[model samples]
Target: YKSGQKCVKVIVPENASIDVYGSGWVCNSGFKKSSTSCVPMTPQEIQKQKELEKALAAEIQRRRAQGVSGDDCETEYKTNAEVCVEITGGDLDCNESYGGDYYRDCDATLRYEVSTDYSGGAYLDVDVECSIEIEYKGRETYSTQTDSSSQDESHSLYAHGSDSETMNFNFSFSSYKEITSVKISSAQCEIDSVDLY
Candidate 1:
């Protein structure tokens, strides 16, 4: 009885019963009181909690072994490495753009010159075609260097078509070891396609 009220009937909750002295409620055998309710803490629940704690401890140990820790940790091991082998060049000596070897005319003194012209467009696709006459493998063959170049003219309204620039390309044939002589002729550049944006 409280607040000046007289005791009438006792209200007992589930998983709970009257206390030992028969004054108030108490949680039953394996249950615990939580605020206004009784919660079960059976043997199975205790076993599951123990297993979870064991698994958590094992996981923390594994993580700590794998270079992960809170405040007290250090690197487990160290390593030193060195390069054993190194490989180098087969790049073109003349123009890095041009590749492969061809027998050419020695009249140009082993050098080839070409000029490129850009048209009135936002972009220009040009081809620097050169006649290659190289004496390779005891035979003379004539071929054309159809290497291409693309130029951007985005900085201006129209590209200057008259702006001509001559680029020189050198030639050498180290593979063909017969009666030797390589002479690259003068190359010519022409616009393949013009783009305007």
Candidate 2:
């Protein structure tokens, strides 16, 4: 009897013995354990468990090599990575809205809206009033620079309509600027595979 079994009675088929008080249960040395019992793990099942553990370890190493943490695997992720594209310049001519606010930054005052449109589609339709600034060097910016010659301008951007019954849409800015991606988790609407520029 082993200590882990804690003095419990040993239960086994005739001529078979289970080590008592052990950290793990196993038949004593020289004892042949019978199969067909659902209480014990079969040899094939044990092998399968080892294989799964090995695969999971390999996956973790692979993710580490790619600089991806376990947290990044979430499909509908929230927080800093959840953000819309950058608003370079001009007004967005959005035809309709389904009630959503697209911000230029994660926590910035600059934002656009998706107007209400019950029309089903492959993409979520929304109206955007994008704002842009004219800088002294003629480059547009979202933030105000100290350059006295800089001026602000805004325009409306309208995306194409769709009836694909999926929350997907394509939008691009007037001026070329890098845009950060976003993930929106809505109780009423489910946005998927959206590409906003």
Candidate 3:
């Protein structure tokens, strides 16, 4: 029962699924799935994963300092090629409204911005998107700063249904090469001035 609810640690066999509610096994997210058995990621893949974990941990700390719960709870992974974040602790009254029950839920990451570099030449030459779950009230707006007096708004997304929803914004931005500071604002909350290495 504890394992099913993800409330306890239980050993699971190989070639199994952790995302499965009661499949009696658990494993990392990045794996090449075949018809029967599961294949682990290569050495290069493991190194990539470690780097990702460090990046994610840094972001999680920043978000948590902003009073966002679930830094230790909510997580995201791939269901295929899409980035999906896990959502938990919804208002029991609003479960039907959210279309989920028990275990974990996956919300597909929205590719909000995917274009050229921002003006002023200080911004990173890459693309970014809103990877957080918007399950609360108000809206999530995407903006970038090129200069002190100006801001860029490319996308505006709204969170419907529950009010006290918890999620993380993918704020580790810029070129992914040398990110100094990151900031993201949603209708319900704002994570400001997060540091990135």
Off by over 4 Å in 3: 1-20, 23-31, 68-197
Q: Across residues 1-197, which tens digit of lDDT does each residue of candidate 2 receive?
A: 45565765445554444432332233333332234112344577456546644664675477558774321121212221221222111111111111222222221112222222222233332222222222211124454321111112222222332211111222332323323232221112222222222
Cα RMSD (Å) per model? 39.8, 28.8, 21.1
Ordered list by TM-score, greatest first: 3, 1, 2
Candidate 1 lDDT trough over 10 residues, lowest sum: 82-91
Model 2: C-alpha RMSD to truth? 28.8
Winner by TM-score between candidate 3 and candidate 2: 3
Residues 5-121 of candidate 1 have per-residue lDDT tens digits of: 676555678999985345556567566545456777669845654564466467557755876322121111211111011011011112111222333222211111222233333
Tell me the deviation in Å of residue 72 in model 3: 16
Q: In angstroms, give how far residue 15 of model 1 lies from its true place.
A: 99
lDDT of 1: 0.34
Q: Estimated TM-score per prediction?
A: 0.23, 0.21, 0.28
* Poorest 10 consecutive residues by lDDT, candidate 3: 91-100
Candidate 2 accuracy as lDDT: 0.28
- Show the lowest summed lDDT stretch of 10 residues, model 2: 88-97
Error of 3 at 127 (Å): 30
Best by the TM-score measure: 3
User: Candidate 1: where is the Cα deviation over 4 Å?
Assistant: 1-161, 175-179
Better of 2 and 3 by lDDT: 3
